[model samples]
Target: MIHAALAASALSLSFAAAAHADPIKIGFIGELSGPAAAVGQDMLDGFNLLLEEQGGKLGGHAIELIREDSQLKPDVARQAARSLVEKEKVPIITGVSFSNVMMAIHKYVTDHEVFLVGSNAGPSQIAGKQCSPYQFITSWQGDQAAEAVGKYAQEKGYKKVVVLAPNYQAGKDIVNGFKRYYKEPLADELYTSLKQMDFSSELSKVTAVEPDAVFAFFPGGMGIAFAKQYAQAGLSGKQPLLTTFVVDALSLPAIGDSAMGIISGGFWAPDFDNPQSRKFVKDFEAKYKRVPSNYAAQSYDAALLLDSAIAKVDGKVGDKPAFMAALKAADFKSVRGDFKFGNNHFPIQGMHIMEVVKDGQGRLNLKTIATPFKSYQDAYHGQCPLP
Candidate 1:
C-alpha cells in the first residue's frame, strides 16, 4: 500500500512538472507571403533572432512563436488577429507592416483583452481617443515621420511641394501630418489606390507642376513600385525627393540603385549608431543573408517590450493593466536610441533624416543627414486622454 501511494504521488509530480514546462506562446501576424511578404518575414526573422540569442526564455518561461500572414488586407488581418487571440490563446500579439491593417485589427483584439504590440503602422485613432492599455506601438505614429519631412522641406525653403500617398485613412493621416508642419503652398495632392502598381500617371502630374520638392508616404510593396517609377521618371533626383516611411530597408533591396539620393524621415534604421541596433543588424544579416528593415528592428523591440512587461508582472501576464503599465514605462533598450512612450503610447524618439547612398559594394543603404525632431512626440497627443 505504501509503495502504491508513493507511485501515485510521483506521477502527480511528473504531471505538474510537464505542465509547468510549457512554453509561453507569442503570435506574430503580418503580410508574410505576398508583395509585402519581405516586410513580414524580415520582422519575424528579427524576432526569432532575439529568441535564439536569449535561449528562448522570457520571464523564466520558454518562448514559442506562431507566425501568420495578414496579406496586407484589413479583413485578412482581422481574421489573423481572431485566430491569434481566440484559437491560439497567445499571451502577446505583434508585427503589422501596413497602417490600415493595423487600424482594422486594433479594436477587435484589444476589446478581447489581448495585448497588441505594433511593430509598425500607427493610426491616429489608436494614439488618440481609442487608445488602450493593452495596445502599445514600437514604431512612431504614421504622422510623426511625415511631420519630420514636412518641417525639413520648409527648412530647405521648398516653396511649392507635391504630396502623394495611397488613398486610405493612414495615407490621409500621413499627408495631413505633413501639412501640419509644412503649412506651405501646396502644388497638388494625389492619392493612389492601396494596390497601385503604376505611378506613371501621377508622376506625370508631379513633373508637370514642377514643385520645388516632392514628398510622399508609401509603405511596403507600394514603396518599392513608387520609388522605382519615380526614379525612372527622372524628376526626383533633380527636385530633391523628400518623403516619410517611403524608402526603407525592405524596399531598398528591391529598389536597388534607383533610390539613391532620396531623403526620408523615420524612427529607426539598421545603421543607427546604437549597441542594440548594431548587434541586431549584424545577427539579422548573418542569418537572413540580407539587411534587416525598420520593420525587423521594430519587431525586435516589440519582443523586448513584451519580455520586459512579462518580467515586471512576474510572468502573470494575465494582469492586463499592470502589464501595460510596465510597457508604457519602456524599460527595454530599443534599437532606436533613448526611446520613451509619449502620452499616447507613441514613441518620443528622434527621426533620422536619411539620404540613400550606394556603397562601393553596389548595395544601397541610408546615411543620416540630420536628426530632426530630437526625442519628438506627435502634435496630436493633445487629443489623447492619458495624462
Candidate 2:
C-alpha cells in the first residue's frame, strides 16, 4: 500500500510537469550592435514589454524569445535566421531594423514556412508581387512616410524641393515615393553612401539651389548627423526641412534642439491621443525611462498581433493555416488606431505630418500637425496576389 501511494504521487508530479511543459519559442533578429542599434533595442524593448505585461505568456503558453544581433549585415542576418529556425526551431521570427537586412533574410524565413512578422523595414519587394504569404509587416512600407511629407509639400506649394537619401533600396524608395506625390520640379536629388558622415557637399548643393524646401530620409545615426549639420550650416533657419524617419523620438533626443521645427511624417507618434497609445507611451516611459518611438510602438503591436493569432488558434502555432488566417484577421488592438493589413501584408493606415516641438521638459518631440493621407494604402498593393 505504501509503495502504491508513492508511485501515485510520482505520477501526479510527472503529469503536472508535462502540463506546464516548455515555452513556445519566438525568434527576433535585428541590428542590435551598430549605428542602427538604438532602433533595434527600442523595438526589442517594446516587444518584451508586451510579453512582460502578459506575464511572459502569449495565448496562455509560456514564451521563450530567442534574440540574435545581425549587426546590420546581410550575411550576419542570414546566419542568425538559420540558427533561429534550425536550432531554436522558433515558429515565428520578427524584427528587422533595416531594409537591406530584411531583404537578405526574407527568402530563408518564408521558405522555411516560419511566420515572419516585420516590426520595421518593410522593403518594397516584400510588399508587392514578391510578398510571401507567411510574411506580414506591422510597420509602414519604406516609402509611406516620405509620401506623406511629399503630399504635404505639394499642398503647401513647395515648388522646387531638394531631396536627399542614402544610395540604397530604402533611400531610392523614399525619393521615388516623394516624387510620385510631390510632382514638383526637383531642385536637386542627392544620393550619398550609407556610411557617409559628411553632408557638407549635399548641403552646399541645397544652399546653392535655394529650393523652397528640403526633404530627406535619413535614419539612425545619419539622421542625428544630418540634423546637426543642417543647423550648423545655418540652413534650418532659412529653409524648412521636411523629413521622414529622421526626426522622431529616437533621433530627436540625440539631435537635441536642432530637430525642433523640423516637419516629419510617420504613422505613429508619442502624442497620439488614443487609449492604447497613451498606455503604451506611459508604460514604455516608466519602464525604459525614455519615450518610445514609432518603431517601438510598431514592435509592440507586432507582439500583440502574434498573441491574438496564437490565442485564436488555441496556442497551436503548428497549425500554420489556422494561425495565418488569424493573423490576416488582425484582431489585435494597435497603438496606431487605424491598423489593418492590406492584401500585400503591409499596413493600410493613415500617415500624419508632424513637427518637432519642445515639450515642457525641454526635450524635442513630434507633434502632429496634419493628416495628409487620412486613409492611405501603399501603391504596390495591387501587384500583390495574396488575399
Q: What is the TM-score of each candidate against the true structure?
A: 0.93, 0.96
> What are the per-residue Cα lDDT tens digits for candidate 2 across 114-232?
99999999888888988999998999998898899899999999998899999999999888889988987888999999878899999999999998999998989999999999999
Off by over 4 Å in 2: 1-18
User: Could you report the Cα RMSD, in angstroms, for every candidate shown?
Assistant: 2.7, 2.3
Instruction: Give per-residue CA lDDT, model 1, range 1-387, as digits (tens).
Output: 999999999999998996687677788888888777777887888778878878887655678888888898889888888888889998788888787888888888889888888888788888888887677888888788888888888788899999999998789999998898897779999999988889999999998999889998887788888888888898756778887767877788888777888998888766788898988888888888887878888888887887788788877777877887888898989898797988878888888788899755667887778876898887767788887
Residue pairs whose backbone atoms clash in candidate 2:
none
Number of backbone collisions per candidate: 0, 0
Tell me the TM-score of model 2.
0.96
